[model samples]
Target: MRDVLGKLGAFAGALLAVAGVIAVASFVIGLLSGRVSFGGLLVAVVGAALIAGVARLGKVPSLLGGYSALVYLGLFLPIVIVVIYAFNSGRYVTVWGGFSTASFSRALHDDAITSSILRSFRIGLTTSIVSTLLGTAAALALARARAGVRTPAEVVILLTVVVPEVVIAIATLIFFVNVGFELGTTTMFLGHCVFNVSLVTLIVRARFLSMGDSLEEASRDLGAGPISTFWQVTLPRLAPAILAGGLLAFTFSFDDVVISNFTSGAGHETWPLHILSALRFGLTPTLNAAATLMIGVTLVGLALAALALRIGSRQGAADFSTSTT
Candidate 1:
């Protein structure tokens, strides 16, 4: 009897979730059509309440699944809109201008956009390199340090990451100004490296800690010097983590707007800065095309990072298994 009730509760929760989704979709459509959707909103709210109540009755998985779907939808909906409207035939981004790829052509032909893109890429590349090298060194040092030193160092490093980015940006800007440094691409690059080094350090440190020093010991035992062992054994194993961290740093630098805004002095613009400046005038499909292209690049970078991490994990497991055998 309890099983039957549980099954029935699950079914009811599923129905409520479905109804809520349909109502939300209708609400969105009505909003797009320039109409207020009070009735649809009410239905969605009521459906959500019902689902929650069912969840309290032990249908939690169904409720959680629906919630997860909603969360993802909220997160990706705007990105989906931007990508879809990139091809809009209309000049403005919001209106349905029919499907056309002219915006992409315009974006490509625009010198300002192209130049900003190149500048961003250069800054991102430079930031990634600096972050990777410094972060790797920090990770190596921390791993060998005493607990007292490691704890303090880790707290300092994490503080750089956990502190608000706006604060970092403002602090970096003030410091540069006080030091009489010119704000330009160089400043922007330095600002990015500040936090990115911490990010890369955490990633590499995690990988380094998980990767035991047995392999390095083996190489040393076979008459390999520290430098030789690091080059031959340590580097090969650590490459995936380094690559993943670098890719992530590059992506963060590429997408950053706050630091770039604060540090990029007059006359120097990255792609994100360019987009912000363009937005003051109005939304254009060309901007949408550019954003869509950036989204594609970001997605590719993230995918590659995830793949590298997965590969590293698998390789580590294989190596551990071989050593144990």
Candidate 2:
């Protein structure tokens, strides 16, 4: 009993000693030469110490899990902030003078912003549709083609997908400059399409591989033509995956900044471009509100899609079983 008590006491004392040292160090550094505010430095030191303790524990505790939850929140929090601030009567990003809908009313009335938003939506839709169609077709072709041909095509597609966006953006810029092509929405559209194709192909290929060939064969036995079988049999099965993949592609195009930064033609501003330009002026809760709204929209879309897919899948399985038995 004595031995156990001594060991516990010593461990506790050592831990306290280490914590005290950390507290003292934090104070000294925070007060040093006015490089950092005392409050800010204290926050930083405490944050580091907490992170170090978590690392030393060698496992994710409930507290750590809560921290992980913060990632999801952080991704979305800004959007909520943006939406709320959009309605703020304040014209500027800062100084929330009063709660008013003047900003939203102003935003709605701004023809330029509205037009840009519409153009962005159009680009996203077109990109998603084009990328998904081409990608799914390529995936199907790869699955059915001779190994030699498929191998080369797959390699090309994989390379296109894996290449860094910066490289693609720079290359696009160079080509446009060389060709004397005026930057416009078209360039942005083409740039997005190029990147999206690879993403779409990978997603569709996974679905294709997982879906064995037997079902298609069975459809052929039922007197369905190749085209009919594809539309009726193959397509229905792939629809969920296609929609999911397309949504992913759309979301990507909607949020893309790096590619847009280089490809978007002058005078044709996008939401992201506007945001980037605005940041140079100053940071404000206005951005935060916009971010919050975007997060909400994305979550709502994903949730609706997931629910629809669940329902469709359950119905599909039931129908398949009934037909088989």
Off by over 4 Å in 1: 1-49, 52-58, 300-325
How many clashes in each candidate? 0, 14
TM-scores of all predicted structures:
0.79, 0.74
Provide the global lDDT of candidate 2 against the true structure.
0.74
* Superposition-based RMSD of candidate 1 using all C-alpha atoms, in angstroms: 6.7
lDDT of 2 by residue, 131-203 (tens): 9999888877877779889888888887778888889898998998798888988788888888788788888
Q: In model 1, what is the error at residue 127, expressed in angstroms?
A: 0.4
RMSD of each: 6.7, 7.5
Model 1 agreement with the true structure over 255-284: per-residue lDDT tens digits: 899999999999899999999999999988
Each prediction's whole-model lDDT (CA): 0.86, 0.74
Q: State candidate 1's TM-score.
A: 0.79
Pick by lDDT: which candidate is best?
1
Model 2 CA lDDT for position 143: 71
